[model samples]
Target: MDPAPSLPPSYEEPAYRVFLDSLDYLPPTDVERIKSAFAFSAKAHAHQKRMSGEPYITHPLAVAGAVVEWRMDADAVCAALLHDTMEDTGATKQELAEKFGKPVAELVDGLSKLDKMEFASYQEAQAENFRKMLMAMARDLRVVLIKLADRQHNVQTMSAMRVDKRVRIARETLEIYAPIALRLGLNKLYRDLQDTSFRLIHPHRAEVLSKALKAARGNRAELLGRIQDGICDKLAHAGLKADVFGREKSLYSIFRKMKDKHLSFSQVLDIYGFRVVVDNVPTCYLALGALHALYKPVPGKFKDYIAIPKANGYQSLHTTLIGPYGTPVEVQIRTREMHNVAQEGVAAHWLYKDDGESSADLQIKTHKWLQSLLEMQSSDSAEFFENVKIDLFPDEVYVFTPKGKILAMPSGATAVDFAYAVHTDVGNHCSAARINHELAPLRTELKNGDLVEIVTSPKATPNPVWLSYVKTGRARSKIRHFLRTTQNEESARLGERLLRQELLSLGVVPISIPGEAWDALVKAGGQQSLEEVYTDIGLGKRLPSVVARRLLAREDIQADKAQHMTLAIHGNEGMAIQLARCCQPIPGDPIIGSIRKGSGMVIHTHDCPSIRKSRSSEPQKWIDVEWEPEDGKLFDLRIRIEVKNTRGVLAQVSGAIAEAGSNIEHVSMDADPERLFTLLRFTIQVANRTHLAAVMRGLRHIPEVTRITRERGGEA
Candidate 1:
């Protein structure tokens, strides 16, 4: 082995010695290279100091020490030592590449934040920085490992920071960094980050909890010892050689459970737990059997995670039992390998020095998660951050495909979420689902072991209603992307039609307008292309009349001679046009159009009071519009019925509406038991005015109904 290199005279001896000892497991060449990297980073940050007044090099050395403890590769350790060089010093990536090679340079670069870039807000900047790190993480997992190590050191040494800054960093650490550590299966680091952040964010609460935990531990020492002895005796009797360890819940975990479950501290059970590490998979189950025999097992508390591992590749058998004195005891049974994986997660691959099946499985799971981050790259930074945040805290439920392929999803995930998990196209065209061989709605929440078969149709498109219930970030982002794309395309088409109509009214041939004229319009509107200008016009952001006038500015045509043209309304225009709910205009109603910025045109009945008020206030927004022939689309209209307060009256009115071939979309009642009459409001879907009238007439036939009138002017 190569001798350790001499350090700078200013270096802290004890910290450097500890860091050097961690690299003893590496080869001589790797150790020498890492030493060279440390020398270069020390020179780069020699003059800098942290907020705690410690030498800045100490921070990088601490980060490197963490990487070594995680058993990361030599390159990752080198990158961790130089993580802040490019961001905080004059050190360039090229210099690092020439000194330590390209992989180390890339890792260091990925660990650096985008502090030099300008953003609209602090949140935006944070999101952009996170997005950049995640993209780099997708390419090399070591990038985030180094970054997490860097963050871990920063949070641990943030006592000298201002209260506001400390709170901000602690909140970010708790929300993003801690969850990410847990997702990666770095259990020790996860708990450390969470507990440190909780202490910083709420010092008093943390102190109280810490004191209470100590008192509780002291009180339960004897009982816990007895339970541990009983478990060991049972395992020994069952002829299963195992190592048993007692564990306690962390203060943050205890506080979170109490807050989330609305439980008092005294009511929290299973605060103490035990882990039994056995020889192999079969021995794990055997240990579980022995533990169950030692105590009465709690029903619905046994989970065989060994049969179906967690999304992060965690595998174990968990059971809660009623121990002596009727107290609940939690136990986890697993093999030695499973214990290593459960603790170290992806880092176990390097820690255990094994390329076994467990390591391969962890790699596959991590790869899938990284692939999802890549898939979400198209979203805006803030949106991408939110989506990733949702994914980082998943409580998973495993479901199966019809072909028997198992897929793990977040708890409360719907059929739509499953469809998207299968394939984006499947989700886009998903019409219905068959859950467990029975027809079910797309919003139906899937349970564990569900055989979910998605029904797709070529003609079916994603519904806006799906956004309300889809649980997965992938599904939510996909639906939003589809809606935005479809809306923009439809808006551009509508803009073209409106512009062409206006051009014709001005006595100009729509096709005769030169490309130069269109280019001029785009420039005037401060847009990238003519299509964008048209989209703006269609979205009501730019008035078509104003654009038409600008197009004819160079022509010798009389602008005053232009005739007004009516835009025809078709119900199938999609998101480019909306029917105003205030009036609920049907195909046969006399309607007018009002341009709503960023919302396209809204159609309202000509006599609607809301439209009248809008016309007087904003005359330029009003446009002459008329409805086209009905295309068999249903329109919703609210109707009020005055009926006697009697039993079965609601059922009778609903039955009469159904008999008239109309569907009741929603219904509500305002009643008083002391009065003889009650008012019922119904929002029903019908073909047109005639169908609505027929439904009203049928309602009048009910003996209990005194009068009926269609509601208008405002929301019912």
Candidate 2:
């Protein structure tokens, strides 16, 4: 699809030459391929101009330069050069494939958007584009590398666009692209993108931070120099050969620290740090020792990444030291190889030719993460975006498995996340977990270095509740997927049973309807088939009684056999219908049913306040419901009791409940320390309302019980 006509170019050659110069690491043939792709893209947009009034090709050329700076593959450079072609210039993917070959064509395809695919809203369009780009990146990590480069360049030149458009793009870059860079361990790109986006999205805040940082750097110049010189001399005296460089934290990093910690600019420490890159692992430790000896090391502030690498494979010895004039200075010690990994992250294998560890190892890790994205891909665009973003945060904690393997998970991840990280099967069948050899709840937050053991049972399965506390997107998505499948299966069964029961009670007595009549019934209800109708009925999307009435009215049934009857509910209906916890209605209560969307019948006492509130707005949702006699089952009844604040009051209350033949399933206390009385709430299992009344009467007989009341309508 061709876009609006582009403006004429004013000047471009010297910048293009500079871009070509950055490709010194590329092979001569690869360089020629990049140039060829550039020429093709240039020809495609020969008459087009960017918002900045330059030949639109300059944007792609600039993006290619960023990709080259990232040291991406030759195909990435070619893709970066032609990233806009298919999206803007009416250049078809097939034509690009013929010219640039399949790999480059595929990279370009991944980088391109479905601009011609009409969407109902801008958000829908954006979500679709975001999902498309991420899936492409999942297949080829280079796709995101090139896309981030493209975004970096765009954000840099966004001032030329309309103000609202510029702000929108900047916000997108900050929220999406910057996090991806951090997740990939591209510190340089991450920082650059963050700072650029920060400047555009929050210019005033960025300006304030920039000024504060400049002043701080100047004020500490002398002290920082002394610290750097002392570290260098100490390392040399220790017979360690290393390069000590002063590293100033980026403005964006400082801004984040201040904002997240709620600290002022001056209160943010570690704004200026030092990095010591040595020749080998032994030298790295020796350098750390020397630095620590020179400056008093801060206790509990040391992290030995060399022993336990981060999830992104970054390794270093990080320690904070009290520098000259009481200023805190952070020092990072790593081998030259480690330093490269620290800076470039996963891209280090390609950016700098490594000797021992090949790019294959890094690629494996990348592919694992990308595979998770593919696994969690959803048809709902917004859901897909949200789930993928959950994986982009870089903060992590390292925990151990039952065996000695260390698994890195996101911060705040629970034991359930660890189970899933181990294996999908283990997670699916996880029943209980032991953290550090002690039984712990599945929602327990995992700590670093804790050894976790997950116990599984053959009958165990994923719980929907796990989604509430799971930190990892993989676990949340998997649990949700399992629940959806389970719900569908259960709903289908329940729907069938409900439909049959309704028909039998209505005296229709037909096993099946004629195929044509069923088809007409389904089509009239805007459904695909009779099965969906049943499933919907079971899931409460449609009332089974309504569906039966619709079908029975059309089909010939003996009028004499038709009986006006209300179906008897036995309270063992599974998910087809549930007794509302708000009222906890048993067989003897005057109960009414509400057909909730996607959650079949909910039985509430007729006097329930919640039912009364919903009844006005949705009178049709109310259905006549009754209970069958002799269907012995337990139901929960909540009662609140006020007792004197004296010793053994709880024991007495428990004894009274046991004597009444009602079990106290749960108890909560709201007691005032200085008051004469305390309130206790008990959720007790009883056979019926009469049984509950007996329990309440038993509690009142106790002298300590000042006030006793049964709770209903969502109280207590």
Candidate 3:
């Protein structure tokens, strides 16, 4: 806890001196540790130079300075100074850990790129590195904080790099880093990253917008000053002391507004606004009322974020007012502490010395987001990266749970997303939802302040279709993970069945294979285990016949004698066994199975034209498959009917089908008003061919019907 000593006159590196000066808030011991880390990093990178022709040590120093500006702890600052040692130099994590603490070494390790590993593509390598860093961030938040500082410094000095490389880095900053900054509620850093990246990517457009913004600033200076004065006077008259200032939109935000809204530069009003900083929450509302009385408030343009904070813990009262000369003026009101949190985000944990409720709330919310990243750590690198990107959306809606807890969600988020946000189990078992006490579909989009109640059933599971509409990465990743796991299990079961049948046909007993034989087979196939080999087989990447031969070859068994065995279908096998849509097959039909890659077995009627063509081209893929006896299972079949054009004909046809114990899944009609006859196609569910015949007979009894025929091969 001793105070840091003064720096000697011989130490004259400006960046290092400035960085050390920022450490005044830290104790002498902590500052000494940071200095030692800097010395170590400088020696490690002494021979290296950056693309900007500066000593590589300067880069780490600049990154450490950024971290210091965020008021991070001594360990984080130390880690920032040594972030690149493991990646560029021969310095080992063990050495760093022995020098510094384990935490600092771990942070540095997380920030280092995976340059020693080989990958199929550059994008793949980048994704792996990102995944590694994100996983580490989940364990310790300082990892990402330091990494962001590093990325910011790298992006700021990219002018010396190739144009293509600069563009790539700029785009990554805009798409990933900028959004991540905003997600962490680091508004200042977000704005700086966004504006810098925008300028680099679209230099010409940024220049034009910069010139336009400058011109508009000159024209609006008088009006902005007048509005600021008016707001300050109104708050003062109301006996509330507040800090009011004119705020200008960033260059990137202005350009985004124009591009997204398709508005001309002149049409984008509220380019300049006012932010009022108050003493407390109640005073913020009072100041808001005073400002509204000063100017006419715009309808439907006010958002009370204080009541329901944003996903990133940003809270404020935002409103738009009609100023003098019919121009719109935007205003934001919050407490002084809130302003600090808004600007520094999670960094306010250290920026503000107090561990009050505000800081605690920010910590809880930030940890919740970090926990979600950990939940997705099992996903592939590319998919994990995509999910994180989807989660970094800034626009959000606030919804309430049944118990009055407010949950902030991405804009356009549906009930499924809300369910996942509530809990992964709720999302997995969510069957329906009740929005505002009214029962609604799971896909219904949620709105602000709407009360949402998720209806979950033990028997329910995530639908693949939910992936199309879900707005949050958590929901999407959970659904995908569930589906993937389920698919693998189902495929393994099917592969077992296929392999058993193949073994029986080759006069071999399935249970006779020893564990050693299976292990040998797995090794020969270059697989991790027997389950993966089965999954590959069931996924149709490997043929069952080929796998059976390989297993028998390991056992030193001959396949000269063969006994044919037919694979049985129960009509209820999940994902692995699908019925052909072109020729819908029921329980009693003559069926053939085709193994489609990544699709498992597709059942088709023996006489199906598509099957006929496929059998000729891929006879080896066709298997002897027969339907098991019907056990009250229904299958879909298509039928075409020619009927007289008349009113009530549709109702009569539907009634007859229902009377015949058949349910119509879907129906379509094609009738020309000038024609006497109409064509109706119905997809009906029934047990077997006999049940289908009963339905057709019942339909024939209608006098309006001219012909009845079954449809196959997608033909009428």
The lDDT leader among the candidates is: 3
Range of the 10 consecutive residues with the lowest summed lDDT in candidate 1: 1-10
Winner on lDDT between 2 and 3 is: 3
lDDT of 2 by residue, 23-66 (tens): 89989878777777877878888899887788888888888887
RMSD of each: 2.4, 4.0, 2.6
Backbone clashes for every candidate come to: 0, 3, 0
Ranking by TM-score: 1, 3, 2
Q: In model 1, what is the error at residue 616, expressed in angstroms?
A: 0.5
Better of 2 and 3 by TM-score: 3
lDDT values for all models? 0.87, 0.81, 0.87
Q: After TM-score superposition, what is the CA distance of residue 497 in candidate 2 from its true location, in Å?
A: 3.2
Q: List the residue pairs that clash in candidate 1.
A: none
Q: For residues 187-248, write the lDDT of model 3, one tens digit per residue.
A: 99999999999888998999999999899889888988888888888888999999999887
Per-residue lDDT, model 2, residue 533, is: 81
List TM-scores for all candidates, in order. 0.95, 0.91, 0.95
Error of 1 at 649 (Å): 6.3
